[model samples]
Target: TDQVQEVLEAAGKVYTVLKIDEVSNLGAARIRVRSLLAALKDQADREAEAAADAAAEKRGCPAACIDLNNLDKLVPASFTEKADGVVAAAEVEQREGASTEFERVQFTEEMRDAGYTILAPQMAPYHFELLVPIFKRAGYNAVLLPSVDHGAVDAGLKYVNNDICYPSILVTGQIMEAVLSGKYDTDKLAVLITQTGGGCRATNYISLIRKALKSVGLGHIPVIAISFKDLGEDNPGFKITPKMLYQAIYALQYGDLLMMCLYRTRPYEVEPGSANRLFDYWMDACKHQLQRGVRQSEFRRTVRRIVEDFDTLPLAGEGTKPRVGVVGEILVKFHPTANNQIVDVIEREGCEAVVPGLIEFFLFGIAGGIFQQPIGKSKKSALGSRIGLAAVKKLRKPVNDALEKSARFHPPADIYELAEYAEEILSLCNSMGEGWLLTAEMVELIRSGCPNVVCTQPFACLPNHVVGKATIKELRRRYPESNIVAVDYDPGASEVNQLNRIKLMIAVAKANLAEKEAEARAARDAARDGAPEDPEPVAEAVEVETTEVAE
Candidate 1:
């Protein structure tokens, strides 16, 4: 037992050194290693238990569901096959002669009468096009808001408190400002926002925007929160129709695939705007397919054609530019609510900004539901079914595959591994949400390959604070060379304060790079002198010490 303790101590020390020496992201790496180790142990335990269950079943006793509370069983194969059948049957619901012609003509008249204009978040062109017809079908004028710009951002920064993400303020500001500008009647115009009610600032954005409106005395205007879930209870009630939900989810999946391809091709193209242009063209094609109710077979052919076209675009940007991986609170990471025009800021700093999409978060949510332990007979019986098991597995695969594929390009850290780390953290804390995973992503991304990370959360957001505040120390201890900054956005946070903090983080990143270069130079000189390099030893340090250094 003494010898075993010594071995563990030795392994821990080596783990610390290897983690620190190879990457500048200490928090994510340490968390990742911890998670991976736990996952390995969990997997071993599951396999053994499964084997025992299989043997018991062979002896004629039926295999009982594993503790549903502990492990989310995959949906059984039978369910997957049945789900495929359901999907196929639903495809037949597409109308061959669905007449939007009458609705379009009527909407055009209503728009002229009410002076109503539709506003959508600045989404990929593909998404916008698909959404436009849907909004039109619902009876409104719609256009994707222009990409966020500096002037609009500046105005929003002036009014918005420093603590809130800048982009949300600007975009909301733009919408509000547009209403006030008399370009459209205040009574006739409305803007749309999406709500997930998930673990992020996005869930609260509608309230923030509404409050902002009230402050500006624009309280009469309607702000629509298009929810895929039951998020907003106070606002203008909009029940999601089955047709609407189906169309919206399909649009989301289609947009996700296109965005993935666009980013992948953008970095390697030979002609600037080729990818963007193809994206535009594909959006039109996708809209046509969806509107005409084209079969899946036809949609696949169109996607293939789009992919081929994307390959022809030129990669115009600097290929070797430093890449900054952004993680943390899902909404803030993807939506502007958390990060405050961070992608633009990073681009201005001459770095490529990579953000994980919404699909992964959705997968997390669904799988999280499955992971819930069964409380009674219903849950146990449900878990015993093959369909339930297969459903969970199917949902999990896309996210896992995407994570692994994304790692190949950016290679900073393993987020999936970090998920387990977060799971363990939640297990210990008896909690789960965007907070635990967002914090874990910070540690994982840094460990995987990205030392520079910006974690955005809402001011006074307890869960996010719990995840982010403690990471400062862990980050430093594991990656003394890593650069991380947490930005909290609210109506009152000053822009200067947020930017100043980011500036400091950037400076640290630069210094870390400089030190790395110096070390390489020193190694080359030592080699010339026929001297051996001496590796530094590792030590166990508390989170506070690292945070102090960062401070």
Candidate 2:
């Protein structure tokens, strides 16, 4: 009773203690507990709905007044004012047409064939490195831009609002800096940005890029929007064909496999750069195969060869080492520049880094559409989302199968399984940026034997705060042995402070690992001596009853 009361207090749930006589037997006590929990859950739900209603009212947009069907038409008046300085100028340029000598040029199929270069920002080096070769093979002069740096951040800050998310700033800055550097012919170069078409501010990134380009007197250079949705409907020239989409998906899967292999082998390799060299070899081989128009049937063979190659690398002495899993915002979690090379830092600290596969994110986007069906009025919209998800799953099977067959790598969890893990803790309807997917990744990491997790989020991502930070206490309650820390990355945040916190987590990981090893050694020695083994005392498990609360 005391333990249950303490847990309720810690979770911030208000409950009155029941007299012992009032709950006379175990069954009666259980019934009382269930009733109290139900009441608390109802109270929480009511409060959450009231808060949401209040927020909507304060914003002066009634729930019914906002059209979910068309997100572009629902921009509030206040948002328009905040974005006017940037968006208005771009809109003026767009309406003026190229006859007025506007700098922005649309990238047509003709431009692609005419040797026009397209630059894409680099988020994950290994993934982008492999992905670039596929683009080259497809006859698109696509180049992954250089790593983000202080210069990119400065350039981003100059044109972009500082209050915007850090990734937007870095992406805009990297492109603008590249353009101004005279690295490519101004007439033939274009920049590509992704449009999520969601409620999050990320949907505004394409607009931000256009505004920045116009401000820099480079409005003539086309800003291509790459998205699965109809957000880029106006850009007919930058269309993605079925073959191109198929190839890109395979490239992403291959990149994920290589990244996993690299992280698993690099830390303990006898030669410092052998794993990297082999990685480059496989990348080149895969690119050549892709160029030759290798059939999907050959993908499994390719995966096997790549795994066999990595297996040949000489590894140094290794026992169980500290394993740290990284989960957070897409850009900061994978980009070295954004997170200050966190994976490298973890490796340097003698730990193996485990990052979830990028395919999971694509799956998350598909899942989001399905999750939102309940809120939408159109059955057609729900049907479209179902069809889209089914097609993606069909396409994903070969890649998943290949990974599962590989002996040296860990297979990614099925999308449904990930969603199930998330459903256990968070509501499926919470489809914000990353949303339930972030929580699912944390659960996946803990279950996969990497309990020490570093959740890296940009300083201003609100979705991350709700899904990442807010869910940690509940996660800890369920997995008491989890060693987790949330690290915020921003221009103003101190690197020293981030590193210090990570160091502390690492210290705890090392101690726990040492203790486990000691216990194993003791058991083995006792068995070898042919003497009566001392009985090991078992620790009592603490039962923490918790109700799922949506944020």
Candidate 3:
């Protein structure tokens, strides 16, 4: 009763709508209260929406007014403002059949044949490295932005709205810096931003990049939006054929397999550079395989070879180091620059960084749409997503089989498993930023023996805060042994502060591990002596805190 009371207090004050003792059965009490609470919550939400709509009517268009409000939150001045006569100026331009050139320029099919260079942001190092070759084989002069430098941040700060998320600034900066560097023909250079067509601001970054470039006198450089969605601006200039798509899929599988192998093997290798040297060799080999158009069987053979090489590498500390999982916004979670070399920092702190595979994120996206049929997802769209999900599973079998056969490697969890893990705390409908997948990764990591976790994100991402930081207390309650920390990266964030927080989490993890080992030894001794008595429960030392700490 005391423990139950403590848990209830930690969760927040619980109101008794229908007392369990007052009802005929416990299940009836829960059902009655659930229905009542849901009806009241819906009513409250509707009232709030109606009130917001009334206020927005006075302010202008509801959606635009909301956007304007978000933009002007930290300052008195409006971030998006037009001059008083701008509407009349637009009318005059309409009458004269001439207009100022703020219109978006499209990348036509001609640009592809002309050998225009395509610039994409660096998200996953291994995945993009593999993709560049796959892209070249299909004939696109592709270049992943080499790095996100300070100059890019300066450029982004100068043009991007102050209220935008930090990732948008970094990405915007990287793109603009590349355009201004004179590295490519401004007339023929094109930039690419992958969009999910989701509710996140990332879906609109294409326009933000375009606006920034136009402001810097580099408007002639076309900004291309790459996506599976049938958007009007989805690059008529470049096309991905069915064959090209399959090759890219294999690259994702190989890149994930290689990443898992490298992170697992590199920290403990007997030879200082052997793990990295072998990884580089395999990356080159896989690129060639894709270029040569390897069959599914051939791809499976390569996977086995890659695994055998990594597994056979001589290592000292196979399981000595505690595993720490990193989860959050995709770019910051995977990219070194965005998170300030967190994987390296984790290894340096005597822990192995266990990042979730990148492919699962794509799987989560496809799976989300399939499950959202009751909430506006079309039947046809849901069917397509189901087929895509199944196809991805079949496509993944080669790598899965190879990993399952390895002594040191293991395959990533299925999308359905991740969804089940997330369903405990949050609905799959909570899909934005990293969405429920963020919470799901922490659960998966804890269950997979990586109890210490670092959840990284840009400071101002709303959905991240909702799904990442907001769920920590509940997660702590559900899995008391887990030690998790939330790190938000911003332009002005301190790396030293971030390091100290990580060290604290690691300290707790080490203690937990020591306690677990001691318990195991005691259990072994008791088993040999006759009857074993119940052991005392181990109390978790780390407590949940909602404060933002930068990574």
Which ranges in model 3 have alpha carbons more than 4 Å from their true place?
A: 1-101, 147-150, 524-551
What are the lDDT scores of the predictions, listed in order?
Answer: 0.57, 0.78, 0.81
Sorting all predicted structures by lDDT, with the top scorer first, yields 3, 2, 1
Candidate 2 lDDT over residue span 210-255, tens digit each: 7788877778788787776677346545667777777777777777
Question: In model 2, which regions exceed 4 Å deviation?
Answer: 1-105, 377-407, 531-551
Clashes of 1: 43
Which ranges in model 1 have alpha carbons more than 4 Å from their true place? 1-133, 137-144, 149-175, 186-191, 196-224, 228-239, 257-272, 287-295, 298-319, 329-332, 335-340, 371-418, 424-433, 458-460, 475-482, 488-551
State the local distance difference test value for candidate 2: 0.78
The TM-score of predicted model 1 comes to 0.54
Q: What is the C-alpha RMSD of each candidate to the true structure, in Å?
A: 26.3, 20.1, 18.7
lDDT tens digits, residues 366-422, model 3? 887676766788888878888999998999998888889889888888888888999
- In model 1, what lDDT does residue 16 have? 24
**Best of the candidates, lDDT:** 3
Question: How does model 1 fare in lDDT?
Answer: 0.57
- Candidate 3 pairs with clashing backbones: none
TM-score of each: 0.54, 0.75, 0.77
Better of 2 and 3 by lDDT: 3
